[model samples]
Target: MADTIISNHGSSEKGANPLPANSVIVVLGASGDLAKKKTFPALFGLYRYDLLPKNVKIVGYARSKIEEDDYKKRISAYIKVLDDKVKKQLEEFLSFNTYVSGQYDKDESFQVLTKHIEELEAGATEPHRLFYMALPPNVFTVVAQHLKRNSYPKNGGARIIIEKPFGHDLASSRELQTSLEPIWAEDEIFRIDHYLGKEMVKNILILRFGNEFLGASWNKNHISSVQITFKEPFGTEGRGGYFDQFGIIRDVMQNHLLQVLTMIAMERPVSFSAEDIRDEKVRVLRAMPIIDPKNVIIGQYDKSDDGTKPSYLDDETVPKDSRCATFAAIVTYIKNDRWDGVPFVLKAGKALDGAKVEVRVQFKDVTSGIFKDIPRNELVIRIQPSEAVYLKMNTKLPGLTTKTSVTELDLTYKNRFKDLHIPEAYESLILDAINGDHSNFVRDDELDASWKIFTPLLHYLDENTDIIPAKYPYGSRGPAFLDDFLASYGYVREQNGLYNWPHTSANGKL
Candidate 1:
């Protein structure tokens, strides 16, 4: 407990206790998509980088009857063997891991898992347990109850890391929490919103609070409208059953993008501790009411103009009459001293021109004394694909007679830090869970506040069948109304060719 389990990349989990010398990371739905693609691969990354505790044991649990070799193959499929060293590490990591077939709600099944865990911890002096709930929401509480009852460490502390789709809405989210609170204390639960684990997303705090120039101007006086966007270039190719159940609002905007919004709009925390960071986020959310319908625009993508990509309806798994919005843009306000009138636009879509998550803070234009029609200053935090942070500002064109253009002060991660390994979002979050750091995790109250912000509008979408989402061409930016929606909230797009990341990063000139 004296030493902390440090992350491979720099992490803000400084105040947390080290992983207990004897601990087990149990994946409850190890055979599912989340476990194979995210959970196992993340654990492998921790193992590869030697960030995990030396004596820790990994246990995989699920109802599926998979042979040991097959399970290992499935789990390790997504883990890339970059070299012979990684190949050797993957072999040793597989040796360190084991699996169990069990029912989520059945005590008998969990007892078998507990027996397997105990066998692994036989000689351990103080064994701790970390249960990762990668299962769906319907079985969250049942598995939590069973794990608490059956597999919880006898003398050491235990924690659970639950994945998203916390619930469909506020009432349902609370219902899910009600079952969980009785079995596990708040501190023992790590509700993961993986967006918080992204490199740029985590940097938002330091970018704002760690620097004086940025911190001084981070308020309504200097800033105009803030936009948080999550755009994916490809549609959900034929996998619409689960996606149709939760539209774009629940899928991306409410949880991931809203979490990003809080980091941008929140006041500086009293301390860097998890409780303090999460507390500030809750206060920011509490200052706002449910988003007004008039401030929301929803859209579903049509087929690409060409004869290639399929529309949302073209997916056989999706209902023919499904009207779930594939894209949504909403403008909401936080009624606090720092961000009173500044609009925060949260836009998300499945099929678009490009794939990236970013936050753009548009500043008020400079007084039009000499530079009339000059673009406003904007600070952009790119969250994925290639992480970067840049500020678009007015600059004098070289060798010109008082001509101005928009150029950027860029910090593209790849260009600046060559060959640096920015850990995947899941890897960062999983490491936080192991280190017992909740700074990036969602608390019960925080989740509730987020749900409260979007539930009313979600209900309206579900109840009103007559409301049809506007159509937009697949692979395009979004619906035509998207521009008008943003404009209504006082957002002005920067001039084309003013800035591009590749141009900025390649050379200093843009």
Candidate 2:
């Protein structure tokens, strides 16, 4: 299949310059875990695939002072060197990477960093610079200001990429945006919601707009409810301090799950342009009502049933009296005509049954008296652990009898695309930033609208300490109110819905 044409503003034209002629990819907070584990590994992945600019230089910037050899070792720790040939390529990739240590807020340090970058440019004209922020939120604004004031590219364009925990809530998010907007243009800043970079999440646009049946039925009239969920089997363990401050809602639901929900509920854009797609997402968010506290469920994990695992409060890093919600299930509704009465449920938590992320779209029940409360059809899109798109439809039981049973038309990536390479989310996103594509990256206005949808609820949860989170045992399936909460929004499971379809072969046939 040929590449789909993207007509978004600032997007590259087909067959045009795939990469900037002269550029440096700099990873700020290079000494941190995120940088070593995800940033450098993703950069190496792009270099291995020959996706980076031929003459590009890579730089690691952080406050930790380390020798060049140690810096290389740290960044390359997560990369798989594999065979001798791959090891040689790894050496070559590292040769292009250099490191610089400096205070994030110090102008003198940034100036030194700027001089180092200039020395590497070696008289190249108009070299572009891509700055990735892997640091904590506390220093985001100061780092942005310092970079803008001291190290911005002299001739070529500059792009800054930063990850989430964008803010504790809307007010602080606005403050963060305000600080950066002055230092960089809205187009120059690429806010990272790595979930948007996932293989299947990226496919949502294609699945919805490319298929007529799915597109036509993706609305309130045909769909009964939509759910976006994130589950993890393990708790924060010893690192509960950071997790305690924001809880599950801020950590996942506010940004990651909300972004996924927008993709699932957004109307089709006029064209495959970043601006148009994001415009649609903002529209959906704007039409949705603020999430009500009554429709929200919060929970904290206690000891496991067997008493082996410890509770969230037992973690030494977590405050004993913390009211932070480790688990949250919030029901939201869109007031727009396209999805007037449809319910969109967003769930995310730590220490659950398993780890997975998925979007489920349940269609309305059969409008007939012949079948006894037949199960509604559903379209499931699994984003991680295994990537698949399967549709649950009721079919006649394979027997002389006329009984109905649920079977799925499945498209599991492993089964369908053998030997396929699904790039890491960070890999896809970093390459998009380098190529000047904003389709997968979040826009400023989109971020604002997302915060607007949840700000009130966040404030409420913060101010009212009396509204304690319900307790659920660790490793259990969230709160005991899970079923009741879901039922309130019309999520009903039929008695016969337990039947499973036979696993399909590589050819997609039973």
Candidate 3:
């Protein structure tokens, strides 16, 4: 892929085309925390790696009129600079940045932005433009329309990157896609769901299709259940106002975990191209039926027993009688020939025991008369905190006794890729945007298919305000009924021993 595209240093390779010399990346909502923490830091990472074209300009657009020095300070605060050389690179990256204050809906503001970009690209050839919308959903379409109408490059190409929470439900999601698809071509719009860029998430395909052993047991005949979990230890500290509008389901389970589930359950694509991969994903999602509320469990966090952490209601920004769920566990089934009757459980929560995200694929138990009640095999792919791929299997005890133990064949990236720098999810996505690689980005039909599976449950949860959620103390794993919920779906839990991979047995870390 690197050889296919020219680097920002203006390389003259056989098949690589030099990046537009006059490219400009404009960061909308530049005064917000997303821009400062994620968008700008990602841009800086690209610049430091020499992946961004030389002489390309970066513009910051927002409604706030902060001082240029202050704006620069906020955005660079999150960039990690190891030494003086990287420090100087950060200084140089900041040099190309300039700020402009503008309203999202007004055309005059976009015109001003266009004029500034034109002035910056006065003498350079192929003045390409990229607009990054770091703003709230309410302003997404308005800003996109204005950018297309007023600031769209005439002689060069233009691309726009938009973030997730595309909409609250299926109807709204379709509306969002309908409104924007007309203004921007499908190829030019980059719908970003940052989870797709995670290192382990990207490796799922290689882990499944590249390895015959794992791929062989990836169907209903060999697998019992699949669980995708996202847990966060801390609640929304001060962003309750935004978080309350869309609870844990919309925040994590609906998009992020569901995306992971699709990757796990989809059939192998014909090719590794963007459309082929996404086509397979859409097929799997279309086979999945709308989630049943009966198979769903919603919970709200109460104050911890230690009383150190705050509950959902304790947040001043949240409504006192809010029925919003802070945690959710949903069961969905794909009625395809490959995964028929197998349960796929997606769970997400805030203020849980710890922060972790992983997919646990539990294989069916051994059908034998030799050993009494043995635990089933499980393949675990840890997506974050500590990236690893471990397969839990039964092994004989060292002694000459007819005993068995559960151990894992592990692949921790930290031990294996010791010299490799694992790029942040944002860094990977931004680089893909620069290279025009749409493989990691979301497509319109993908969004529609995903929403179709969750919209009915969302509507039920919204209408039934009188129904109270299960209360779990902050920092605990989850509600008491969580185990029962899993059991209902024929999910078995190991009751014998503490299972710790990579750190347990000697030579297991490999």
TM-score of each: 0.95, 0.95, 0.94
Stretches of candidate 2 off by over 4 Å are 1-19, 494-497, 501-510
lDDT of 3 by residue, 1-510 (tens): 232332242112123223466689999999998998999998898887788877889999999988999989988998888999999999999999999888998999889988998898875555788889998999899999999999988778888999988999999999999999889999888899999989999889878887898888889999999999999999878778889999999999889998999899889887666778888999998999999888999999999989998899999999999899999999999999999999999999998999999999999889978877788899899998889999888887577786776787888889777767788898988877777777788899999999999899989999987878899999999998899899999888753553565544532232
Give the candidate number with the greatest TM-score: 1
Ranking by TM-score: 1, 2, 3
| Candidate 1 residue 510 C-alpha distance from true site, Å | 7.9
TM-score of 2: 0.95
What overall lDDT, based on C-alpha atoms, would model 3 receive against the true structure?
0.87
User: Between prediction 1 and prediction 2, which has the larger lDDT?
Assistant: 1
Output the lDDT of residue 405, model 2: 66
Tell me the tens digit of each residue's lDDT in model 1 across 23-117.
88899889999999999999999888889976889999999999999999999999999999889999999997898997887999999998898
Best by lDDT: 1
**Each model's lDDT:** 0.88, 0.87, 0.87
lDDT for model 2 comes to 0.87
lDDT of 2 by residue, 1-510 (tens): 133354433333123223476588889999999999999999999988999987899899999999999999999899997899899999999999999999998999999999999988887788789999999999999999999999987777788999887888788988998988878998788889999999999889888887897877878889989999899999998999988888999889989999998899888888666788889999989998889998999999999999999999999999999999999999999999889988899999889999999998889888888987788888889998889999987777666888766778998988777666899999999988887778888888888888988999999999998999999999999999799889888897543435455453332345
Worst 10 residues of 1 by lDDT: 1-10
- Reference-based TM-score, model 3: 0.94
Question: Model 3 Cα displacement at 363 (Å)?
Answer: 0.5
